[model samples]
Target chain A: MRAVVVDDASPVPSFEQVRSQVAAMIRSGELSPGEHLPPVRQLAADLGLAKNTVAKAYAALESEGLVVGDRRRGTLVLAASASPETDRVRRVEMAERAAVRYLAEVGHLGFPAVDAIDVVRRVASAD
Target chain B: MLGDWLSIVVLGGLSSLIFVSGLGPFTDRMLDRWCLRYDVAVDQHGREWLRTQLRRARAWRWCGFAVGTVVSALPMYANVIDRNRAADFATPANRFAPWLLAAAGSVVGELLSRRPPGGRRAAHLATRHWRDYCSSRWVAVVGWSVPVSVAFAVQATQSRDLGWRWSWLGPAVALCGSAAVTVGLRHLVNRPGAPDGLDRLVDDALRADSAHHLVGASVALAGLGTSHAALALDLGWLGLLVGMGQWLAIAAWWYVARQETWNVARVRWSRS
Candidate 1:
């Protein structure tokens, strides 16, 4: 029962926000194989976003092989694929969300994108 | 003829009672009874918010009840005024139409209460299922028995008591009603629930508690339809006995609801 938040003020598009959060949930095994993703219309209404935005996010997930959609059974997470491509997609999405959150928080402090990335590089090497 | 007319008058008077009850005193009692069970009252604001919400819901439900009463009463009224067409008007088709309409109208009214509050901040990620709100095994038994009751009515039709036998309306309403209730309840259970920012557990609890009324409405409506079926079949004492099964459904619901309320209260107060 993990949740997704749509931060209205974030620079990321709503669709990406939805896609990334749901993607993260699947990758972390929060939403399992055969588990239903919330109905697109319901998720859209709750997030106060357009239904198309949610639908587009779902489309992105289906394209990534993270979920499958059926008109009758609704959108569901698919079993994890061992394909390297699927793994890369999940990795990139997880990093993108972390980056977005970091950038959003740092952007408020008047830091440039270059400075934020530099901080990330410095912190990674230090670790 | 005199006894028949007297019976019509008595029936008409019951319709009026149904009307006055629709004005909302009874509905309010129903609302309070079911809601108070899950009134978590995390604070003064949450409590007051729920109160205002319920008041608004009560207003909408009253309108629905009024609409149902008027609809059901129209046929009964026509039956009286056009006494010459009494046989046609008093047929089981028209007789049970009111109950069916009234049940549907009430379900519509329940839907109206589902407007999400303005500026909700977060939503539950969990997709609610019927099992989440109502999973008692006993409830399953009562729900399954509704079909048996309907089936009994069908079996009763084999008798050549043409004057007192059942019509298709009773079974039709029960079947169609089961479908309608299924769709209606599924929507209610899964619909965007309590305002997003409320404590998730509290929000879930409030929604679950509200759903109990819907569960009750469903069972009560099925019971009414089944009761009507038994009565329509004109099984004499046997029909009356079967018809009383509705009360059993209601009683089972009531006992379960009360038990749930006490269980939650005891757990919450004791632990927290």
Candidate 2:
């Protein structure tokens, strides 16, 4: 399995780092549907994270229908979106990557990502 | 006298050979066999990396053996042969010399085996992983602390019985030593950065390394307890039991460390 790198020094919290990375992996088809992710405890230990942090990330992924957690089995990946297609996956991957880059850019410019999103929403409403 | 020196030479030489040359290849062969049995495909680069590590380890072990032999021989000559003060050839210092030599040798070996460029990034990632592990498992930190506390209590009680006006001295020292060792192991193993290749295997390797450190610490404590029981409490049987426990712990540690290291290699290859 491809390892997720979490940067503690970044403004992003560990759980967000985990969540986004897992999401990206799913969208990129690196983690396929029905593939089991590592156990929460194991991943937490591997990443030197609190088990809760990883659990929270997994929970977020589950809520988004990106993965499912079973008591007997482990956490398994689900389709990234409503339908699985090469183009759809590509679009989702690109969108996610763009969002990350935009957020990072805005942050570097000393603006909140939410403010930028609000500005985009206002423009869309006017249009 | 001649026989004693000869025996030391033979034993030291054999130990050096086994530690420096024999174990690495033996471990590698076992890893290969296990991987084959499990249908794990090891990448060429991963295999090369593992081999390189083994080579470095062997060199360290040899260096340690050589240093230990020379240092130990000095005491044997001066205390036993030259002075004829005692028939006992194995003084405490002499017995400890090899381990000291080995420790120094390993450090030197590590220094010599510098990672290539981009190693820093790998190391940073590994450290971050380790920090996450430690932070998440706060309970484990507490678990380790319990042993050190217990050790302190044991030492303190013994010291008081031995009529030390400063009973806390022994306990304080013991506590500091245990804490230092625990912290040192955590830092040492985690500092190297994450192993490249299979994430699963890297996790297993880290787990195994942690287990090895915990077991090693337990063994050390058991030895300390045994010594205390025998020397302080005059409980020979109890000391014997503790000594046996220590050996058992050591045996378990060896098995886990060996198996996990190989498993780590397997994962690295399988992923590669």
Candidate 3:
């Protein structure tokens, strides 16, 4: 079974860990559109976190348009879009967020902006 | 002086043994062996989670033990105090009430103590239903039989009137109580797996073990209740024999509980 892990030891915040993993799953299409996410309370209880932590994660996912919440049914994965233009728009938005995070991480290692961008191309071709 | 001391020592030792013997098989010695098996908790997270569970289980045993001992003491004292006690005092309720009440106490303790917090963990994407934990064969046999037997007992009990003005109330209470337990078992089975990061086998084993016991407790209660209701109501030969069969089934439960915990381990769950 696929899982979303929240490691207390991780530098990333617990709610961010949940949001990032769930978002990755949705983008990869591992969680299909219309699939229901586990309820906030159940997921929070399972992870032994306060309910608000999971609720915040869910809210973040909802704002990113990866999932939507319903009063009766619970959170469900949403289709990125049917049109190619909207899909590219959502894709670029995600790429912009990733590029910022990547740059911040590499900058800590004393890499200049040009070198960091060069490394992304090198890593992409190597993969 | 030495002879007097020796006699006192022997008598005191005997009394202690007799008291401890009544606590049944789930003793301190056996509990150590059980906890040792869970040294299977390789990581600190798993160990902490299991430690809480073991603590709750042992803690509740004390609660139940105290409840049973106190309840059982009442009838035991009454029997001893009055050697010439009338037949009324020797009734089934009088004879068996202490142990029955003790069992009730233990059960209540288990409910009070069982759920431990689910700590840091990964969530399995799939949701588990109550049906996943048990076997279909079990459902067909014991599942169908529990309600059927309870109903039979309720019907057989009708032949004789309890001393109460509303005799039907006794059986009604039994039915409602059984229903509540059945519902509780459903919720427990359906509840999410342990909060700790456990391997699939350990997780399934724990779940199956709990579900097995809940069913066992219910069947035992129903059988014992039926036996008492029929016999206490003085529902003659046919009803009494039906009651006897239920009694025998409960006796089987004692064997299964002891033997299965050690022997069944993993495969029993694999089949289900």
Candidate 4:
């Protein structure tokens, strides 16, 4: 997977940005199962984040069971453990989260709630 | 003497041609290997830039060869061929004329070869960055300075024992000259503006070039400084410690340069 980008100006914390990006890559199958992520220090330098931030993101991924950190080797993506129902529920949660973020962004752009919903509906139906 | 001059001219000209022709392809292959190892995908513009550098290198090599040959030949003729006229050329100034000529020729050759396609501002920024790289760390300065300083100190104290009032002059001149050349050469080699086609790749390549120059300058300065110190102190044992320090400095410089180049390439690639 490509290096994760963290925007300092964003409301999301840097660690969360790293965590969410890695998680999204995992769900999208871009980061393969058993694939090794870059070392924490390497990733931190690449992303311009503190070592603690990258380490925290990796720890969060471990807790979520998406990846495992081996002492000798590096961090490895774990084979996903979700059942089909759980996977569907996870997808729903991700979609709702994305929708909320989209709404928040559009709201700041002077988009009314009805117009935002209409825009989403139009984009979804067109897709 | 005439036979020696003939042999030198013939041999030097042939060697110079062979060296330049061989070095161009060798350097190109080396760059290709480096790119493969570092995962740097060179675009069309990068290739063009590499071609330009190779061409310039060949040109500079030939210029150096020609200038060196002329310089050596003049001294040889003065000292050997023209026995009666040797008195005039035997002065210290005349003896050192070849080196001065070669140095001047190299500078001119470098300037002629380093005419970048970019604008002045880009070239200025590039030169500034290259200078920054050369003198970035106090440790590097100290690394070159300590040995030379020690040599000067030793010379000052031992000048009476050695029966020379100006024993430190040569070492001082050598130290200052090498330092100046190192900084100047580094600035000359770095091309500032982005290449026309592959902006990112060219940028990475230029950075890698900067790193390579830094490593070269550091290693050369280390050798020069240590040798001058050994000469002044006349202490063979001190060589061991100095050599170790030089090696450590070289390793550190190489590591730093490699890290910088890798970071640049990685960041550029990631963005793309």
Q: Which digits, one per residue and each the tens of the lDDT, describe model 1 over residues B5-118?
A: 665577566656655555534344554564566554445455555555555444444444445445444545555678666555445544445545554654565565444555
Relative to the unseen true structure, what is the C-alpha lDDT of residue B272 in candidate 2, on a scale of 0 to 100? Answer: 41
Q: Which stretches of candidate 2 lie over 4 Å from their true place?
A: A1-127, B19-40, B58-74, B84-185, B192-230, B243-246, B258-272
Better of 2 and 3 by DockQ: 3
Between candidates 3 and 4, name the one with more favorable DockQ: 3
- Give the alpha carbon lDDT tens digit for every residue of A13-44 in model 1: 88998899889888888888778887887777
First chain TM-score for all predictions: 0.63, 0.63, 0.63, 0.62
Candidate 4 vs. true structure, TM-score: 0.43
- Full ranking by lDDT: 1, 3, 4, 2
Task: Report the Cα lDDT for residue A108, model 1.
Answer: 99
The local lDDT score (0 to 100) that residue A52 gets in candidate 4 is 99
Say which docking band candidate 4 falls in: incorrect
Candidate by candidate, in order, the iRMS in Å equals: 3.0, 7.9, 3.0, 14.3
- lDDT score at residue B271, model 3, on the 0-100 scale: 31
Ten-residue segment with the worst summed lDDT in candidate 3 chain A?
A80-89
DockQ of each: 0.21, 0.04, 0.25, 0.01
Per residue, candidate 2 scores C-alpha lDDT tens digits across B1-272 of 67667766776676666565634553668547644533445666655554555466456646675667666766555554565654455444464355445444543443343332221111111212232222223224324534554554566566546544233332332343245345544544433333445334543343334434333333333333333333344455774775465355335424433443334343333344
- Order of the predicted models by TM-score, top scorer first: 1, 3, 2, 4
Please tell me which model should have the higher lDDT, number 1 or number 4.
1
- Measured over all alpha carbons after superposition, the RMSD of each candidate to the real structure, in angstroms, is 12.9, 11.9, 15.1, 16.9
Off by over 4 Å in 3: A7-16, A34-36, A39-41, A52-56, A59-127, B1-66, B79-120, B135-159, B165-197, B230-235, B255-272
lDDT of 4 by residue, B98-164 (tens): 3333333333434443323431111111112333233345335534565665666476466535533
The deviation in Å at residue A25 for candidate 3 is: 1.7
